[model samples]
Target: MTSIIVFYLLYLLSLCLGLACVVCVCVWSGHWRGGFAWDGSALEFNWHPVLMVTGLVVVYGVGAVVYRIPLTWGQNKLPWKLLHAALMLIALILSIVGLCAVFDYHNINKISNVYSLHSWIGITATAVFAMQWVCGAAGFLLPCSPVTLRKVLKPVHVWLGGIILLLSIAACISGINEKLFFALKGNATGTQPYSSLPPEAVLGNTLGVLIVAFGLVVLKILSNHEWQRPDSRPEGLAYTPLLQEENE
Candidate 1:
């Protein structure tokens, strides 16, 4: 029961990260990109942006780990260990690639091709992430469940997360192979694909990037809260908190 509750909260947190990033970027874009064109120059490395991205990454990675850790103070193994592990690993990879994509565009102006890979990874990751949640909800009888429904829980979880993970890989491949934003004259001195992310995909990928990063930060905070009693989780997280806990 406790594990089930924790998983739901984790899902909420993941979603929060995604939606928050969308809002942040939309707000930032409105302010930052006015009439200004990306000039292939490196980002100025402002503290807030760095903190926002890094904090989210750490939070996400740790949460990923926590979701899959196989034991939760009982003799039995943690339920859905594989699903959690796979999802977390995928999230970590996507987050790293997202940072890379940011650099590729903001610094090298070599992102059209790079964005392909980044986009695929992100979509695939998100797909997998979403599936994980669905299976989890159904399996846990989340919100509420019938006794018979519980019988299919394990299979539902395994299958759903797995499908999402597989799709993410496909998305990853397709993303890296982008052909839509091919070469174009730079509006700001040398920015290729000056289109600033295709209108169709911009909302999805940009928001995905920011949200994943933000989610990581939130998880990291939960993991590192020192006042909470320390548990048997990992100790080396960048923003290590003793235990992963949440309510509702």
Candidate 2:
């Protein structure tokens, strides 16, 4: 029972932190960064941050924890698996759109692309996430996948989920710092520098902290063995071998 309670508390905290990070990024980009547009302008670039936070971070994190939720233990695993796959698909699409938006903005403004540490990490994270999603869907969701194949892929999938999330968080932090450095040091009149702790800088910094906190909490919950779903099938449910092996 204590384990159950701890699971709930950690899950709720992670959810709240993820949501807060989304909100912070939206406000930082939409309210402070001249709002959003789609005409290959800086405004269009704002979509990159907002969608990345909403889809890649928040939605992806929620999907990762779907299987860990105690409330869903009594239900069939197939539905949960479908939900997880659906969420991942959505996240991938959103992240791709975010990437496109930034690339479009850069191209229109004649700026170089993929030249910074932030771009390298962010692109690599997104590519890895896409590959992970594709591999998971092919291995787990397909009817032709043999049981042995799933047994092999499950552990790899689980391990990669956490690693991809960490990569995303690192990318977010680096991107935030890179953007702040540019925004703060720009010759925009009346705008205070990062050293001045301006409102925009404060909000951007807070968004980075929220993203990190959310990732850490989710990772902690994922790593807690006491909170893992039990091997025993719930009452009235057909037997399932989802957790038959610890490595899986």
Candidate 2 TM-score, C-alpha based: 0.92
Q: Which candidate is the best by TM-score?
A: 2
Give a tens-digit lDDT track for model 1, residues 127-163.
4565565555444524355445555464565444444
Q: Which candidate leads the pack in lDDT?
A: 2
Off by over 4 Å in 2: 186-188, 232-248
lDDT of 1: 0.43
Query: What alpha-carbon RMSD in Å does predicted model 1 have with respect to the real structure?
Result: 14.5
Worst 10 residues of 2 by lDDT: 239-248
Candidate models: Cα lDDT each: 0.43, 0.84
How far is each candidate from the true structure, as Cα RMSD in Å?
A: 14.5, 4.1
Quote each prediction's TM-score: 0.32, 0.92
